[model samples]
Target chain A: MIGVNSSPPLPIDYLYNFAKELFIHSGYVYFPLLFDPDVEKELKASGLCSRQHVEIENSSSNILLRDRESWFVKGMSLESFVSSYEKLAPESYNQHLEALYKELPFLSSIDDNPITDKLCTIILEILPYFVSKNRRHERKKLTRDEVLELVSEKLNIPPVLPEHARRILNIEKLRVALNSLSKARPTCSKLPSGIVSKTEFEHWFSESLKAEIIKNERRKIKRSIASREKFARINEKVLAVLFFAAEKGSLEIEGFGFFATEHEGEFIIYKRTGEYALKDYYGRIYMFPDCRVAIRTNGTLDPFVIENYKHPFLQKHAPGQKICMRNTLLPSTFTAQNAIFAIQEGISALLYGYKYRKRNGYHSLDSIPMPGSTVTFDDYMVPKDHPRILRGEVLVTNEFR
Target chain B: MNLLDKIKKAREKGKASIGVNSLNTVIAIIEAYSLDSNFLRFLDASPYLIVERKNTGSRFTRKPDLRIPIFPLTSRRNYLLAKQVIEAIGNPYIRFSRAPEEVYLSKFLYRENPSISHDELRNYHFEILLRREIDKKKSKNRFQ
Candidate 1:
């Protein structure tokens, strides 16, 4: 039978409670077991008394129980004994034990021979600097040559190396250099083709070409105005016909009663009791004023009518019969009443008869009709048998000898 | 005749006319019965049988034949009688001249229970079952 260890130094509850409290404070699910003879002896010497027992048994369970109290106490002081752990168990100690366990092959190789230990020592010495150089390379943007120089200086390695390794190390740097150069000097093919140089194109567009366009536009406007003036002249001609027709009853000028040599397609007309030169075209006659009246009638009255007219010539030359007035000489304010008034005034002037009398007892001035009165001519009383007409006919029949 | 005897006599006389097609008369009878049970009970106890007849031989067979049945107030007789009462109540609201039997059953016996057949269940029993089913469905959908 197994005898119980030395009065069971720490009660099971106390040990379990202490372990639980430590576990809770550390927030660890599992903690390592620590049991060292020297550490236990030191603890005992220090007067931190704790019971200890030794047991040898066939099963691992008995051994674990025999050292349980010691392991707990030592494990509790693990932080303090960290340096002493190597001295206590130098052969089994390893700082990277967890890593070595994870990488079993590496641990096995290192454990197998001294050669691997030497290799690991060399790798450890250079690995940190190489890692730092690689980290710097990744962080900073540098040219390929710059990166190569930095790597060589940092790792204390020879700068001269295989071209492939150099390229591999500076691949990102090479790409960055190529990208920057491409942006700075873009390929000619990438620019727009068939384009003039910038300065020449801008000079042509702004100064010479723009001035030419403006000059051409002004010429076009002048040409348009010239054509418009021509069109207006034609339009005035068309409208002139209507204006003439509206003023005169007919286009014939003979109805205006003027005696003159009858040119072919032309005639003289008396307008406003003044002789006018007239010309006919296409069965229509146009008249122009040739004389001014001595006795002026009111300008607002129709100038067409000689109000005092009682002459046979005047009766024959009534408006719409042989000749008519264009009435252009009449004032713009002339209305139908003014026309009637002018006719009355003219007839009054003619009826009073001009103050000239012939020595033959025949009136020198022709008798004129009064306003609101009709003048009837007796065809028999006219001078068909007149002695003056016979003398004129005789003279016209005889030769000029 | 006694109440059962009168029902029997009415049934025999072919007077158990359940006009499922005419719901108004059925509803009127039901309402009348509800208003005054004595009057309906007296009518139920009467010996007159109201039997609907199919047209076959004559155009003048418009009136239902009044006769008496041998048995009265049995389950089968009560079912036919209840059906007649339901038809009498429901006929007026229906527009068409002819109505399906299911419409009568659905209105009177089924009430709110979408399940259950009026022909298979007694009127009073179906009424209670249908009310409970309707109440249960109502409670379930109350929140929604």
Candidate 2:
């Protein structure tokens, strides 16, 4: 029940694809003939061939296969298949084949046999050529001497001489030199006199030398500070210059007040004045607790209004005048931790608000600060009779002014 | 020089002697010395033929039942000189056991003259004495 067909029924390309898929899916790419009994039975049932015979030829691409009827199937080995197909279809069926080849132990059993050893040597020789910069640039083959030179360069040492001159160096002489160099090197400097005794003179000498070097550095520092009085006069002028510079620099004006920068001669006053044309500063602005304010008036001021102030206020006028305008300056509830937390939240809100406004054309939260703006004392106002300006039962004059 | 000339020189230097109990060993010593007349002269002069009883029994008896008389050299200088002559001929007598008498007899013979004869005497009197001693010991044991 055998069919004698002179030619294969299927096209070589189609048969190759089928066999390649079969080999890959079953992990039999290397040992194509090594089919399990069940798989062999399945293959026999398929009627492609009665038997399978695979042969791996000398480290070449070609594989010679013999069927049950003594028919032949010539193709490439697994390595050749990977190399040839890696480029054609890098992400297709061939990609899977290459991956399986790398993952599976295809040549795991190959040892130092003549054939395998020769193949390895040849591969090692040609590997550099494959990785070289220029593909078409033909360079001379590396001689044994050149290879040795490359090894020396890799080891970060001088290249050995060629041929007979490259014998092993005298180990005894090298060991002696190394020992002498180690002994000649300095030792730890901090040990006490009695720690390194006469029996250990070399150790003591090296340690003492190191200690002397450190002591000399310390002495140099002590000598530099011997004439401190001469530098005191220079230090005073430096302090004055720094004070003036800081005064002219940008000031963080805070508290319940209205700030204005004024140039009085050469000095700038970051003025905080509290005088408004409004009747109720409480509803208009809020003041932090424990702030002091100064109130001044030339006319009668209501006692009930001054007594209702949340903050202490000091009132002052021209000899006998009524309390009217008051200015307060005090640290806000912005502790370092609170300030950092506020800054983080403010920044996050600003970024989120900016992005939200950019996308939707409006801010989602009304309380969030606008980008490039900071919370300041100008955002709040002081009330009348505020403790900032008013004492327990009387108004005090502005001491800072 | 040839072997005979060397032996003659060894004998003249007073180096020749043989073990008193071992006939085969004595014969071998004589034959070796005959190759050199100087060695023969030393052998003839030696007073005592130092014998090792244990090693000599094999060459003397078939059933390994034998005893032998051992002679000692008498003079120290002669013994030392004779030893030097024997060493020159590349043959030396090493004593495994201590025997002051044997050492003295050997020294005396070496100082006398290098022509003493002991091969026939060794084969006869020394062997008979050993046999008679062995017989006397066996008879005494049987009677007891």
Candidate 3:
């Protein structure tokens, strides 16, 4: 299951087909733009490289870089790049650091590198990127007061010197003692109050402190696992139609369809007259919601959607605009709640009428921006004596599941 | 190493400290397996010893049913089957190399519930096999 959903070959043809499907769903015109001859030639030549090289070239990092650079060149600035670096690059900073060390081994040791000034200057230039990139799920920075409180809670010994309790508390010493004790070494007999450590005392303190951190981490992991389980469980019932497809192994050959909807887009227009010129534009196009429900069960987790679109006015802009298909697999957990709900809300703001305009404290109830409208059905239970079940027998359901 | 090797090493290191009173537990396990054709096949393929808990209940009241000898399986197929059987029997303290922890086995069973399908079982087996393969490849790479 680990390797099954790993990186797979991204066929351009399949992507195009998916784009076409999106076009159809979104009421957008399908304009097959001609690729730049030079870029096309380069791509064709690059195709002769070994498969591994191709894989590295097409990796998410390269794709993200290309997209970011394109956005930046098109009037976006380095500020935007710096601000969005973490969002753009979700991979850990350690991985990036490892790659950096591998590339410039001298950077591994901070004390010995001769080019430290130049390195520092270079890093300063890219400091914002690294700063944003390293910001994983943020935790509240503990103050001195909080740290003392946490340590006291872990130690839990009655106050001996009531007046000087705070002054006498040595956090560093306690931390060192705790760390050593954690590794099953009981050599810390040199306490300020020269007392031999007792097993009961050690066990009580160690279990309490260790449990605090371990419990928090375990809770986080369990929540994620539970969320994933819930999503899968709900999908099993809601998307019962696709269950047959997976069961029959049809997903190996053909992908199933899930979503279809439409939304509006803004376009600029310039009008020229004898005295003056003015410009304004607005247009409506079909749009598909991002809740892809057709899970490929043939040892792959690739998402697929088919689209087709036709419109008269779109032909003029076909020469320059290139359609792109980018996917971001958001953090998902198997819980009873649907993982796609958060993603849907994020996409909703982007697709709804240029900017989300609240009409009398409510936005437009367009089908495209809302999930579960088209793809997901309400949870239903099969009734006994229904058409699927024979009429003559009593429904002897098992009391225990 | 195979289960036999693990048992031998554990005994030599004085870690196989279980005494005679827990012979009932060993007998219970063997009896439980004797009813299954697949487990019987594994038993026939390889030599096995059910390490008993000795002197467990007030030293004088306990005695082991029998003392079994240590012998390695002759064939690779038999050895592998015997290994699977022992792993499936679910003893965390077995000390076999690359053996899954009790938590992993519980998680597997929990996830594959209602009932486990053939594919589920195959995938579980394949996961362990793949892990061993990856470890071997890693060690080889490290050596290189």
Candidate 4:
């Protein structure tokens, strides 16, 4: 039966599992190829593992060469492994795989082959050194010619063999897969602190949206607001907030609480009076209100977000939304009075529809019906001519700074 | 160098390249066109127009030499003017090759318009999708 659950341990299975274990530990997937010198001629004639001059190193080359050919597979060559394995019967291969899981405790539960494929690719790029018991070597992949040259120089043989090209892993694809894996893990953070910059916050934010792990009820929230396109908006909003906060040494996310500083590379979230803890891009958790400020928990208030941008304010202000006009004014700087004024202005604008406008070249004002009372903030005095402050452009200032 | 020469040199050097300010202008224009397609025609006819940044508490003025002015999109009229300038330069987002800058500008566009693909930073379908969104909105409004 192809079912691994009921399978018994087989010798081939042990070998297969050993190879997979090597792949997991060393980041390389390889198979053990046994080449007996007695059948070397016949094996070469059969055209399996077809590329390469195996060097027999000995002072007496002629005597050693006459002996049966003995070669072992110690390096990576996916094509060669596949070609060699193809000669094995399907039943045998399947049994071997079953046996492999039975023997290898760590991988015994893993049913997916794609993870192995992913590891193989990563090994190619960040391949570790070919270490010897006595010395350490630089990590590198040798081309067929280079290998052939080295072998030839060691044994003084002519080079004439076609070696398979090393398997190449797409770094971009690997990166994406790794990101997804981090998102899936409960306690892993995709973006750790100390890696993001002010300028890079937006990109990191986008990546975090795709990589942040969510659990139980939060996943439901994600689905409910699925049409709102919260991912892009939340990331953008958070990055903007974080950047501003970083600059000002502290900032408050209007409806959300205040944050004192931003951690270098982290996108954090603090759940406010909710059952679920806020999870950042890196699976770090911070409960709301109690630890709203920075603490020693996995969550840091240095760079904070409101429930990691799942809040209504972040989700609701996208284009085509009624509240889109509400975000017309820049976030106010954090002076106590300015904060209060900013909040008042924001509410007033939303309630009475005080629209933002660009100044035209003409000094003359165009009259539009004004619905709200005159609103002014920090040092931008109302003109006497425009008393009651109705029906003219309201210029924004850098009062927050 | 004279002020004009210095400004000319800066433009020539491409130092005054499009930024978030320019991006918001394009969004307002597209939004205006979505409200009314006649805005597109109005934009095509206008000689020169102003572009503005969101009021994020920064001091930004429309440089006199720049054809596009940096201002806030407070009214339907501003969006109309914004639409004119946006059409002048095919796609403002296209100019930035770097992913960070592109993400900053396009994230809003991508979320607002579902047709834009998130898998690729530079999707050729952006302009097409934008047009589709405008058409969809216009059609929806007609029924209302």
Candidate-wise lDDT, in order:
0.31, 0.30, 0.27, 0.31
**Candidate 1 interface CA RMSD, Å:** 45.6
Model 4 TM-score (2 dp): 0.15
The 10-residue segment of model 2 chain A with minimum total lDDT is: A296-305
Q: Find the candidate with the highest TM-score and give its number.
A: 4
Tens digits of per-residue lDDT, candidate 1, A1-401, equal 00122233333323332232221112111122232234335645855345455333333232122234322221222222233333443333332333333533322222111112112221222222323333564666554344334434543444343343323323344344334333333122211212224343233323332233233333433443443343344322222322232223223221222221233222122234332211111111112222211112223333333333223223442432211222324343333333334443443332222222220111111233335445532221323334543454212111111
For model 4, residues A44-107, the per-residue Cα lDDT tens digits are: 5755435455443432222112112222233333233333432433454445545433543332
Per-residue C-alpha lDDT of model 2 across residues A286-369, encoded as one tens digit per residue: 333221122211111111121222211112211222222223122234222322232223222212222222222121112343
Q: In each prediction, how many residue pairs overlap at the backbone (N, C-alpha, C within less than 3 A)?
A: 34, 60, 27, 16
Q: Which window of 10 residues has the lowest lDDT sum in candidate 4 chain A?
A: A125-134
The candidates' DockQ values read 0.00, 0.00, 0.01, 0.01
User: Candidate 4 on B1-144: residue-level lDDT in tens?
Assistant: 899999898888885543445445454334333434454444333221111222333333221111222433233334444444445444434322222222233433444464544443243333233434556778999999
| Residue B31 alpha-carbon offset, candidate 2, angstroms | 70
lDDT, residue A41, model 4: 51
Q: List the candidate numbers ranked by lDDT, top first.
A: 4, 1, 2, 3
| lDDT for predicted candidate 1 compared with the true structure | 0.31
What's candidate 3's i-RMS value?
29.6
> Which candidate would rank higher by TM-score, 1 or 3?
3
Task: Kindly report the docking quality category of candidate 4.
Answer: incorrect
lDDT of 2 at A206: 33
**DockQ class, candidate 2:** incorrect
